[model samples]
Target chain A: MTKVVLLGPQRHVPTVRSALDDLGVDGPVAVVTAGWEEREREVGELSEHLGCETRNLKLFSRSEKALDKDPELLDALRALNDRMRTLQEHYRLRLAHTMGAVRELVARRGAQEGALLEEEIEHALGAVHVLDQHHTRRTADALGTFDERYKPTERESIGRARGKVKRDLSPCAALLVAGGHVAVLATRLRLFVIDQLIEERPVVAWSAGAMAVTDQIVLFHDSPPQGRGFAEVLTDGMGLCPHLVALPHARHRLLLDDPSRVSVMARRFQPASCLALDERSRATWDGKRWTLGAGTRWLGPDGTLHEEAVPA
Target chain B: MSLAIHEFLANGTPTPEQIDAFLADRTIPIVEGPEVTFLYRGEAAEVSLQHWIYGLESSREFTRVEGTDLWWIVAEIPPKSRVEYKLGVIHADGRRELVRDALNDQLAHDPFGSNSVAAGEGYERPDWTLPDDDARPGTLEQRRIQSEALGQRREITVYLPARYRRSRRYPLLVVHDGPDYLVFSSLKTVLDNLIHRLEIPPMIVALTASNDRLHEYADDERHGRFIAEELVPAMEQRYPLVGRPDARCLMGASFGAVASLSTAWRHPGVFGRLLLQSGSFAFTDIGSSNPRGPLFEPVVRFMNAFREAPGKPAEKLFISCGTYESLIYENRSLVPRLQEAGMTVRYVEARDGHNWENWRDRLRAGLSWLFPGPLWMVYE
Candidate 1:
């Protein structure tokens, strides 16, 4: 079991400095900055803040090289992503109309009409549920097909990268993961399986880094261009955080004031607390228990939000 | 086709009921019209017709009918031109109010003021946004705050339920353009009615005023710092506001909206919610070069800088703009950027132009959605 701490944004204040101090592990740090995309190499400032000999796992570059070396793997992965995008687009349109109808119906309540409206609303809600299940399953199936066919684990380039990543981690005591484009970050982490490479060493991650380590990556935006606001699932996460879905910068991204929206989000991701990763918020999993930080909140199923703190 | 003007008042001095019916029937605008005649009911007090289409001084002086004390004004108007107007009544005492048609109930309000609205046959007033009489009203408590952030003193108005208790905590709504909302939109009344109907939760609203609003709201860094460090803290000491960052919201219109959004982005710890109405979020492809204008330079610079790296998202944001507003396209474009930042956003558009009235009308839906209450079960 590895010690992992999920953190808030580090763009301005670098809250990670205090979190690292709390971890108290003294050694060089390995980083996964793939989320930065092209700017992944700019870890100089990060190294200065961490005060450690930091090295990029370069998983982003390695993934690109691996895909280049294996044209068949590249085509298969490209096809999977394109197929996922098309399915996602279709699913989004259906969801927007359905959710709009459901919300409108839910708002109607008069003695005779209330009962009739509630029934129709529930029916509509059920349809959305069924649609969600279908989308999630189809997405997994599409990605699973590529993995099953390519067996990228057995690929020569990827295997070499994995070996090098493991060797690179040998001298490191912990891992530092920064935020960027979550899809890019999640892809590289999946390909390299750096979670396995680190193997019980402490890990510190923030923003999309925290989201990537969770059980599912949910893409949500209430006010988006061209359509109504509805949250959707992008893909599954690495399941490192456990029984918890981390929403980094939730203060900036969630309609926490609307109980209906809050409750729907909490229930949609049931069994896991929809934790809001506001500024200076952190969650440390110490093998057995979780130590939540100040300013953290979880969306409650009862249409309420409660702030969280580490158990005394 | 011209619809002939036909109205009846009692042969003697008209009864209040008779006057009401006559005025209601006659107040409707003439559509499919080359010309139109408006009827006003009064015995002898000089009545002047002030219209949105024609300014106050140019109001048509009413002519008394030969037989009855009825007053009539005639003017040439285009078809489908919906306009709001008021009567300039000099009751011999010179005491006057920009009164709604005493007999007509159709009214429209903005942050500036409200007026009696008459729509051409084809022009439909958005009746849905109007507040109902039976809905409960909220109370406003006024105070003056000395802000160190901007080094200026300003008035802050806090709104709470009519039966508010200090023991219970409520979510905080920090609204910009406070004075305008109080005079024009009747925001306190809207909150009261919404809460009474269970459309939205009984929350505390802090209406913050600005001295140099344009410069302060143009993505001002010092203004952003002041909100986070001073204004919010001072308000907490005075009210039983919800302390959770997520429970708080920053709302503004036009430039004020720009300030709210930029402040939230810069200091994510202070506020979590944003309600932007017709925000001037101007941005350019090349950094620091804004074709929008000198006034929009700061907002353009801020948006451009944000593009370098997306900041943390706020909780849920409710954004709206009038289709007729110049900033509609800009507001629409900001939607995708906010979503990409992983923000939950609610975008609404009204048919009217950018004015306090359109923004005021949207308060019901936007506020109710953002802060739904225990009474949220009722439908308007």
Candidate 2:
């Protein structure tokens, strides 16, 4: 049973120190900032903030170098990425129509249209849910196929990197993951099997880091440059917390004020509670249950943020 | 509303001490609703307001206080309008000179000089255009490429976004008159902020300059060939750019805008997006004498030719022009023509002049619409 702590973006306010104090575990911590990409090793500020000895695993560079040395495996991964992108595009197309119908029906909820409207709304919402599941499965299958064909863990360069990561993690009592490009962070984490190494250890992550530790990654934004902000399922995460849909920068990215959008999102994900992980938000998991911080909020089916954490 | 200025005026001519008290801790160009009053406290024979707002008097004499050295001019500037102006001071020595408002610190700079900026009511300089400590700055590398079409070595600055990697292929945006835009419009900072905010994707920006822009950027075939044939291909060979036309954008303002439009027109389906600002698209309704002068003859010719056929130059175009600019008519007229040609066009008009800041202000809307980043679309 791993003691997992999920945090919001560490910009204005940071709860990592308090979270660490509550965990009762101190000393050397393994830090994975693979999402930071080129700035992966720049942890001077983070080290000072933690007030503990921090060891950077440098997973980003290791994975990049490994992929560089193994072109065949790199090509295979790129192909998988391309396939995932196409699948996501297709998912978005289907999602748009279904979501439009849901919004239309939701807007007409008070009308005298009766069960037919409610039934249509449910059908539309179900279609969206089915689309999400289909996309998730397709993404899983794509990754599964690539893994089966390439056996990335067994690859010579990847194996070497993993062996080094294990040695680096041996002296650490806890693992801290910082947010950045979530895709890069997740891929690098998977490549070196850092998830497997920190099975029972205390882990604290924030933003994209929090999203990466969840069972599924759902990308959401209310207003983007391109068009409407549709929350689309990106892919599976490390499965550290299977019941959480971590939404970092939710206040900035999401239209929480609009009940229709919020309700649609809340009801779409169903069992997995859509957590609004703002800068002050924090949630701690002790295997059996979650103890949410005061600032932690979850999207409710009524289209508002609730103080209490919805039980997984 | 600046109450001090109003109080000072209400109490008749102010003494030196009173004027100093009014000036203390006051931001210049006192904006009160639709009325903007520009103040200059100095000893001059005459002070007049020199502004570039279209449909308004080009120069208006400022009223000098009888007992004080203060000179003030009030202009009815609409809400959310950004106006740039200078003070023309006629010294007692009989020499006249145009200078920026000494009392006002807010200034907008161009190639020639800087002018004091007077933002009307409900207007604020966008925070994203300014530099942020959190936004990672991109690296700019200068590369000189020999252009066979122009027969000159051109210096093109390439901007690689922060954390740019070889594994990822980025969209390309080719800009004309790059150096001027950097110095005047703060393009680098704008790119950094937009990318950091995820409004626009991390992209490879090709900043190209020309020696003879007046001639070269005036729909010259050689310049078009240089951009489409030489510069783009050279950039593609060196950097990992998405080869598709949609991913490639051509951008410019004024004559540079003309160059961008003509280049895309010459090489249809080569570049997908066009960001044209205050384009010098002078054209004639019928066969007549060119009233815009000899320099615009070539531009008028190009515009005429383009308007005739008006084939799809790019899939989408972001056209912006200042309402105060003389080229507003031409920019506005070109939009319908571009749309008629079956191209997706986004036309934006701002109460600005034909200067770099107006172009700068429109960058976020244009670039984001053209190449939106993963901030909203992609999770990474």
Candidate 3:
């Protein structure tokens, strides 16, 4: 039951506030974005209008030269990989140890005598294996595929990049926005944060946050004159939220200017349900039906309004 | 006073015996000019001096020579109440540099920026008794349900001064995060040490436990009320503690620090002195729905409010922090703000983290400042 609102690009502060008011959510919001002084002022203005909190959340980017200069990040990445390998080896050794212990107990005492002891050892080993696998998978998901192009060379650069990771991890929530293939990198970082939050506390997400939770991300913007706004190769998302693909700013001109094009894109890439959210719209799932909120409307492939009822 | 001139020539060396005699006398006469000349062992040495020396204290510069070799130069520094000087040396190669003294142990940092100094392994634990025995009468367990307003039962520990049994009244220091402060910082031991030394006046220490720490410390007024209405009055009634604002002080660390500061600022008449350590006054975004929302900027509003309410019954503040603490920068920034508002503040930076080591170090200095030494000590 993690609540998230993915605001569309250049959406007014009041519009976002309206969405939050409709949801009956409180304030003290953390704003995450990129850019320089001007953008920060804009963010401040937005925060003032919304009566919440905002901070710069963007860390690593394809633009930052430090990423190219720093070798510490690469070293950290290698270290993380080495640690993961060691953990796997240790897990195997533990399994071997538990099995050996069970064998010893069985040999010393007959099967009838050592049955309870053996069962307890098996349960412990099973729990350890489950935990080890979870950790291994999480580490792998966080690291993702390293980019050879952005690999750092200098120690300071590497340290700065490492610092960025620490800072990103330190915050309770983060929002990452990317326009190119870098989105994959952003998704990986988001997944790492999600995995971290799962182990400790709850975290909320929005557009990219929602996309990070999904299995795959469908780029719904057409290339000015193309048929539908779907990317050639569909990229996998962080998969934090399972079985759902989130389409934010559903009513924005860039994505919804041509309904037919969006419809075609939706048909080509069908999610569990097309969550088309407008500026003031919201949809929540309570492990049951998709409870649609105000400012949101759903549609079918036939271009007809689907059954719309006020979610109670 | 006649300026002694034995060797009155430039670039001449003096004998070791003559230099020793000059130092033994510990008296150097002033020679007025842009530069000064001094005589020793038939060799005249000229120094570009700005000050002169009188007795143990000095102001002007002087050079010395020992036998055939030139010993280190000595400056006649001006007399000041506090000893403060840095050696300016002109080397043989005509290059001038400040002489480095290994014994110059005074530590300070750039007033405008942040800096850190190293400290050795900190506080060690001593054998202390805990009030855990259930059979003991008039213990914390017996006085558990003192107030009905507090939803849950909690143990409050109050420490009266050594002369509390005979004294008619005593000042009080109400502290939050009672268990952690009392255990980790060894609050009782520290209090005992301060009182025994007579650094601070005889006062009672009230330790109040925080049940919901985060909720109470999140810059809320309701949490302030819980202390003012429930805890303060209850303690006053139980102990021979002073109820007036001037005699009462509030102390806390981390989130508790923020709570104490906020409480003191809101009701300065209720609590005069504030001891804030590693307080979280910076902006946070954890509990907000909108990432860039205003509710998360309560600290900004709080700062603005504090700025407007400059002077009051709260006459003194003792703010301290560890160099490595996360809120070091914030605390550093807060000092000037407090000072600018016409409040007497003592800021201390220790070489540790946001833990007991820093707080314990602060306790002695803080107590001495709050309650200065007696008139006899000042005269003596």
Scored by lDDT, the top model is 2
| Candidate lDDT values, in order | 0.74, 0.88, 0.50
Candidate 3: list runs displaced more than 4 Å.
A1-312, B1-154, B283-301, B307-313, B373-380
Looking at model 3 chain B, report the run of 10 residues with the lowest lDDT sum. B133-142
Instruction: Tell me which of candidates 2 and 3 scores higher on lDDT.
Output: 2
Candidate 3 is graded, for docking, as incorrect
TM-score of chain A of each: 0.89, 0.96, 0.52
Could you give the candidate ranking by TM-score, starting with the highest? 2, 1, 3
Worst lDDT 10-window in candidate 2 chain A: A223-232
lDDT tens digits, residue span A181-221, model 1:
78888888887777777787788988888888877777665
- Candidate 2's DockQ is 0.27
Q: What digit string (tens of lDDT, one per residue) describes model 1 on residues B1-380? A: 43444434225555567655665655454333546666666665687778755223546677766655567666665444445678877675767755666655677776456777655445453343456665566778888877777777777888877657776688888888877876677677677666764556778888887878888898888888777777788878888888788888899988889889888988876787888998988887765876667888878888787765657648789999876566788889888887888888899886555567767778877887777653301111
The CAPRI-style docking tier of model 1 reads incorrect
Worst 10 residues of 2 chain B by lDDT: B371-380
lDDT ranking, best first: 2, 1, 3
Considering only N, C-alpha and C atoms within 3 Å, which residue pairs clash in candidate 2?
none
Q: Work out the iRMS of candidate 3.
A: 33.1
